[model samples]
Target chain A: EPEVTQTPSHQVTQMGQEVILRCVPISNHLYFYWYRQILGQKVEFLVSFYNNEISEKSEIFDDQFSVERPDGSNFTLKIRSTKLEDSAMYFCASSQTTEAFFGQGTRLTVV
Target chain B: AQSVTQLDSHVSVSEGTPVLLRCNYSSSYSPSLFWYVQHPNKGLQLLLKYTSAATLVKGINGFEAEFKKSETSFHLTKPSAHMSDAAEYFCVVINSGGSNYKLTFGKGTLLTVNP
Candidate 1:
């Protein structure tokens, strides 16, 4: 089965630095999403992307966060001025229609 | 406005025993319910989903879920458990009839299968 893939399973970045998490969703998927989970917390939705634009975003996705589908296969989430609270597991997901498939996730650590 | 509640935080079962993980949901409209399994260091894998087509939904790994609209419950079950089935289980609810694409996840249930 084809699955979504994320790069750099783990990343460590300094506070106030910029970090970008990359993902390659399933080839035929039409919708993309980003979710995050703080250690011991429930998964929280960050944003959803479709047709090269963001469909919806949560309050947690403030001015510092941005998402881009720079290419047909690559979808990325960039955070400017990373904060200590940014430390969490970020997941990328894609779906052709109803059900979404998730990637292994990228663990972001800010210090 | 949509949420899921997993009744159990942890469950311990011996190998070859039946397993049940309870879940209750709150949605204004007809909800699209799903059960996902997360193994250590792995992504969330979809176990089964109820899209209103059938009340009893069967999925991979001999897992199944029944959507009881009257009860507002969608519970996951397996007739026999295996050591490999130990993992964190999440009950997810999506408002398919609504315009929002967000998915509400439960706190999660950790299942430990013993020998």
Candidate 2:
């Protein structure tokens, strides 16, 4: 079965630095999303992308966070200035229909 | 608002025994409920989904969930648990009939299957 793939399984970044997490969604998927989970917490929605634009975003998705579908296949989530609280497991997901499929996730560590 | 609740925070079952993970949901629109599993350090995998088509939805690895509208529940069940079934289970709901497709996730239930 086809799967959503994320790059840089783990990343360590300085608190003030910028970080970009990349994802390659399933080829035929129409919608994409970003979610995060603090260790031992429930998964939280970040943003949703469709048709090269952001469809909606959660309150957790603030000014510092942005998502872009730079090309047809690659979707990226960028954090302008990382904070210590930004450390979490970031997941990328894609959906051809109503059900979304998730990637393995990118572990972001800010120090 | 849309929300999901996983009633049990943790459950323990022996291998070859039946397993049950409970979930409840609230949705203004027709609900789309799903169960996802996460092995330690791994990504979330879809166990099953309920889209209002069938009350009982069967999924991979012998897992199934029943969508009970009256009870507002979608509980996952396995006839026999395997050691590999040990994982974290999340119940999720898609808000507003997929208008934005943002998923509201439950707190999750940790299943421990012992030998």
- The CA lDDT of each predicted structure is 0.93, 0.93
Model 1 CA lDDT for position A6:
98
Candidate 2 achieves a global lDDT of 0.93
Per-residue error (Å), model 2, residue B75: 0.7
Q: Candidate 1 residues B1-115, lDDT tens each?
A: 7899999999999999999999999988888999999999889999999888989999999999999999999999999999999999999997443333667799999999999
Q: Please count the clashing residue pairs in each candidate, in the order shown.
A: 0, 0
Error of 1 at B104 (Å): 1.3
Docking class of 2: medium
Q: Considering only chain A, what is the TM-score of each predicted structure?
A: 0.99, 0.98
Could you give candidate 2's per-residue lDDT for residues B13-113 as a string of tens digits?
99999999999998777799999999999999998988889899999999999998889889999999999999999999987434458889999999999
After superposition, the stretches of candidate 2 with alpha carbons farther than 4 Å from their true spots are B97-99
True contacts kept of 1: 0.54
Candidate 1 residue lDDT tens string, A1-111: 899999889999999999999999999988899999898888999999988898888999999999999989999999999999999999999987779899999999999
> Which candidate's lDDT is highest?
2
**Shift of residue B77 alpha carbon in model 2, Å:** 0.6
